[model samples]
Target: MKIAFLYDAVYPYEKGGAQKRIWELARRLADDHDVHLYGMHYWDGPAVIEREGVTLHGVCEPRELYVDGRRSIPQAIAFALRVLPPLLREDFDVVDCQEFPYFPCFSGKLHELVRGSTLVITWYEVWDDYWYEYLGRKGLFGKAVERATLRLADTIVPISEYIAADLRELGRTAGLEVVENGVDFERLQEIPAADADWDVIYVGRLSEHKNVDLLLEAIATATTQLDRDLSCGIIGDGPEREQLEADAADLGVEDQVEFLGFVEADADVIGNIKATSVFVLPSIREGFPNTILEANACGVPSIVVDHAENGSTAVVEDGVTGFITEVSSEAIADRIVDCLTDDDLLADLSAGAKAFGRDHDWNVIVDELEEVYSSVVQRER
Candidate 1:
């Protein structure tokens, strides 16, 4: 099947969880089907770039509304408008839409107009007034658009069960299924054991949404309570770096925490993660964090908060695979200490984590996706 993946961002151009999922799925599905990713490019860059046997079409948009400190959405939309006509004419069987708000709000009509084409909107993270918190009053547009898109979609596949519940609350009585993104089984399993270099490690964006301050607070508590001998490694970059730096100092763990900005997706990340004993994600929201998946693949356990959205809580079996905590710094610190000190427990958790990750193999996920596609296609015909 010729699949047109409609999304906001993708790999190499962007490094978020949503994009990573598209990159991996397109590549994996490429083994049998022809997959193409279509996104609006805000920056004045190349129209086309290819990787991993998949073609990436970037519609150049004006650099306004600089989202995530990168490409502009306005230009990407205009570009999508111009480029889409030609591309959509090229005989794709189905459109796999990512980001609910965009498909319905930004590009709903396009899908609706495409007769006989199955529109599968993959809901990664739907905000519960989360965007309005940042984007202000006009964020109502996003919510309305998302609702419209959800209604128009032939199938709504939320990455987590919590998201499915949200769809029900919104009163969109559509066929909502919990079809999560999968992981790279071979690359992750191929990782060789490495020595523990950092006492603690975090590999995600340093942003407000991720709650970087709380992580620093917990680290400070761990440093003093466990003694200030251990080091903390911060991987990935974001806007909240300075605030977090201050928080680290205020907590008196400044010297112990080191922020390593934007590491490449290579063996070094795998090795660094393998060298760490504990993985952490202090986020207010997430669809299904690929970092946790990657960490689990490395046989490392995580310390994530107990938010009931998007499998953030479901990822960890709490004391089985990794520790799941309430949104508290002291609570997070205590879990870290427990995981660090107990060799038998960490070993046991690692065993459970690896097994759980195996269940999320792309082979299984793609089969489910194929089922969604088949169902959509049958209904469309």
Candidate 2:
């Protein structure tokens, strides 16, 4: 099958969830099928390039769409519309619409333009009341657009059982299909031993939902109550950095926290997780976090808030591979203390975490995604 992956950014340029998902699927699927990746242009960048047999096309002023972290919705929409014609002319067995903002609606419109074809809209995210906590939730104007895009889609792909349930509650007709994010099996095994420097590690985008402030507060409280020199390593970067840093200072835990803004090297990421006594994600929202999977693969236990609405719900069995707590600093601190003081539990978690990751190996996870693509293509015919 000649598969076309539609998205806003991909490959060497982007490396977060959206980029990771599309790249993993395309690379894996390309083993047996032809794959093309389409990304909206932002700054008059490269017109075309091939990376590992996957063709990339960038159109639209995606770069100017945002200036100083603020965006112009009108320009973004107009740009996506402008890039549609050339994309629509392409031949594809199936078009996989990745993430939201622009990819799904834009690609869905293109799929509609092509007769006798299928558009499988993969919903890594959706808009809800809680989404007001983060930007990119479909606003009133975007809401109307989402309805049209959802209606036009041939299939709906939800990343987790929780998201599937949410879609059902909203009464969307396309039954939800579960396909999760993945972790590299061999590379995980290839990772050097975890470092022993930091007591706790947090790896992921430093966004609002991540609630790094809460983690800082918890670290401060834990340091005071535990009466131990517990240093934390925070990996990743985002808009919340300044506020989080300020909060750490205010909490008097500046010396206890280290913010390694966005560890680009895998060795750095794995090393931190390996070094830590436990991994932590105080995110208020999530969608199959790749960080947890990576940590679990490395035999690192975790302390996460159990809000399924954020995709953290099914990441693991609570109290097994990792412990899930309420979304609060106090709750997170208590869980961290438990993991720290309890040696037996930490050892058990260390083994259990690695064991849990085996089931979510990319080999198994991507096969499930392949099945979804196959089913969607078959049904469309």
- Which is the leading candidate under lDDT? 2
TM-score of each: 0.90, 0.91
Which 10 consecutive residues of model 1 have the lowest summed lDDT?
100-109
lDDT per residue, candidate 1, 97-116, as tens digits?
Answer: 77643632235346447644
How far residue 371's Cα lies from its native spot in candidate 1, in Å, is: 2.0
**Least accurate 10 contiguous residues by lDDT in model 2:** 129-138
Error of 1 at 233 (Å): 0.8
* lDDT at 150, model 1: 70
- In model 2, the Cα lDDT at residue 199 comes to 82
- 44 Cα displacement, candidate 2 (Å): 11
TM-score of 2: 0.91
| Per-residue alpha-carbon lDDT of candidate 2 for residues 83-162, written as tens digits (9 for 90 to 100) | 57666777778777764664346655566566445677777666654433334554555566555556667577887787
